[model samples]
Target: MVDSTQRIRVGIGGWTFEPWRDNFFPAGLPHTQELHFASRAVTAIEVNGTYYSTQSPKSFARWRDETPDDFVFSLKANRFATNRRVLAEAGDSIQRFVESGLSELGQKLGPLVWQFAPTKQFDPVDFGAFLELLPKAVDGLALRHVLDVRHASFMVPAYLALARRYGCATVFADSDKFPSFADVTGDFVYARLMQSQPDCATGYEAETLARWADVARDWARGATPAGAPLVEPAHDSGAARDVFVYFINGAKERAPAAAQALIARLRTG
Candidate 1:
């Protein structure tokens, strides 16, 4: 999806799901070709593997070469960086994660998502320090960060203000288990929709997919989607902003289908 200035991207969490080998990936498609095929199918993909372990610079370069020119990958930061009891002391871990060859992805890198556990409450001071530790750039390439805060305590004006101050995006998680809300706090919008169903052929019906397409468009134009749950007052800067919508944490098997369906709707408009 596009306007003259900004872009709207749709994707799934990762490319190597075994179920997708039969469901999303073509029959007999080589496992090694999954990224090649997936990169073509969706405009973006969240690199979930980065959350578990650090990848080599060669691996990042290979991923960059595997995808299309316009494709982008949003990486989930290492669990050790964000899953700590003390956020202020995570500077070293944060540095390690950013220094772990992410710059090799170059233009193909989208955003680095620092996801926190549900148990981590909103300690304004601690959270602020964590956000501060995120470097603005690495190896001359600009870095974009997205905070994935799951605790309900983060649903406050202070949290939004902090995020806006640092210009980091906050996740708009669409999950029943998390505090799912939409608040625009940065230069881009990052959403993780997690309600896809295994029964629906396309994960979501035409109506839902169409609605998401509309929401994504609104975000691209720098408007918060009307009727979206927001913790802070909606502000329209009227500046074009890139939007990333990933079908993540749902019935994982249907994420690819959901992403493809949303992409189809986005393309038609």
Candidate 2:
């Protein structure tokens, strides 16, 4: 499911922020090298631009070549695929995105995040049909999918059951603006920490970052931490799991710092 790199990865979303250019990238670093620099500091990155449009195969190949061999990427599926009213009718959009050039990344590609609009209510039949449209592979490369459901309607047992049935991970986003939960639904864990603060140099308070690191450790060990936000009991098959933690939203400018700090903590532990 994951590249043969480290079991746990810590990173931030996108590499094109102007604020990051000033603080995260080394001074005088060419704009073209931002991804190059960011990739070395963090093990994984959430490619947000892909959510707006499908990228060409050459672009994916360049991204793979720019990053370290062990680096990984999580792509957000295009809005065209998830922003529709009828989820069952998204087959063509879904197919176009998967065949767009995902195979170019090979194993370096992690999960495809299909994020629903906050107002999109969860319909069992429609949602099941949508999940069924997600292909298991593209061009002989195995693909992993993740559901980023935002509405409270998706916080039911049935939702988790459905996601598990398709073997797709549900995003564990730490955002007050969205329904935040850490219910495990797949073999691996994916979390988007949205509480990073601009005031804190490390994005998060040291204690909070340490807590997140511990939570990630538990997830990698195939368990959920005590008192974690959950809609149902966590599922752990006893086998170790791969964990992807991205510092996103909140204090966007401090994301790189937060990600680097979390990586340090994960390394020491």
Candidate 3:
């Protein structure tokens, strides 16, 4: 069980575009090398590639070895499980994807993020059923399930309640299309700041990072500000109460700079 009242774990998205590669890692470094470099600064990573395809066991084994033991990898469940038009029909596919990853990632598996497409609307019955099925799917594995629903219709109080009931973390995405942190729910928070405009997206302003850091710190200590709902107790201690903030707003050239800045802020404070 994760201790919520402890230091917050900060990290960036796993895939970095070409332009920002040089700044974060030496030019022409291999993908694994880049991952190692990022791990040195940040303790967690959002594995975006799993959304496209399942990784082979051999590949996953190599990834586990490349990073330090304290590092955590948050995997995005494959698209077939998340982007489906018919939710119930995805059971087999979802099971297969989860099983494949679990075989390789073992204990290194962090949270399994299910990011539903924006076009999909919320169907309470279907969504609830889906959430109920998840715990059984990853039965023995010790990992957290995170929901990143993007539609405006899905941001209601009922939806958040369902997320908490199933013990899944609701992602707090800072995007124009989705609701912000004020309304999200969960014991563990996953924040992804996807950039829309060139100015705010390319790199985080000093104030922006500082503001987020403060929130992350407060959440870690189990002290929600007035009006914020108290987070449910998920673990014996609060050490695992992590704040995963990724900067997806930066241009390909600026992601490393933005990630580095955030990492520095978390460490210094």
Candidate 4:
């Protein structure tokens, strides 16, 4: 059971994958019930569709109602909000995205991920200005933001510092395709593990999942796990934190298995 105010959630990128119907979803399970079933298996999910387009409030509400009470859904912001040639001009787009019924998910809403293009390099003044444009609240509800900066240039400490200053979390992405930065920048930690291989039965070997579970727990207890890449000094306040870890697109077909394996490891411990 999770303690109040402290949670370690492990989940996949999204619940609506066709591959999951064969592996994760029960045989003959209805497509409409995928979210219902996936939520019961994992504590959280990252909503990827929102990154490409805006969804109706009814859709968000349905998702919230379909999931378990403790389940959470982190949404990726639309590309227009983060992909413009001039990011600062994205204010209106961001506002529209937020006002488009995100609050309908209520407490089920997790952090909003702002993923920049891989080609987007780190520019202190420009990036700082864009971060400042992020709203702290949406429809009277507090918002938690996570920056998924893919360029290797964003590995600098200044990027993390800017994120910390805005109380935004920087994605601790685990992938060789993109730079991995494990710095903890906010009250919570968000990680995206994208190295799972299709040939592996469970996406990740048991030993790897167990190791990640250990790291998840360490993060929950406000400690930076040993061996994690760090751009800033580590510190512990002795208070537990909420940690969200997602097995994202690597061997996309195996993501659900990887997430489920990690969840089982954490629960068993």
lDDT string for model 1 (1-269, tens) is 44622398899988999989878899999999999999999899999899999899999999999999889999999999999989989999899999999899899999999999999999999999888898999999999999999999999999999999999999998889999878888999999998988898788888999999999999889887889999878988988899999998768899888988888887787
- Candidate 4 residue-wise lDDT, 102-158, digit = tens: 999999999999999999999888888888889899878899999998898988788
lDDT of each: 0.90, 0.91, 0.70, 0.87
Better of 1 and 3 by TM-score: 1
Q: Give per-residue CA lDDT, model 2, range 1-269, as digits (tens).
A: 54222588998999999898778898899988988999999999999999997799999999999999999999999999999999999999999999999789987998999999999999999999999999999998999999999999999999999999999999998999999898999888899999888889999999999998888888887777888898977676767888899998999999999999988887776
Candidate 3 — which residues are off by over 4 angstroms? Answer: 1-6, 136-139, 196-202, 225-240, 250-252
lDDT of 2: 0.91
Query: How close to the true structure is residue 141 of candidate 4, measured as C-alpha lDDT?
Result: 88
lDDT of 3 at 80: 89
Candidates 2 and 3 compared: the better one by TM-score is 2
Local error of candidate 1 at residue 247 (angstroms): 0.7
Cα lDDT for residue 168, model 1?
A: 95
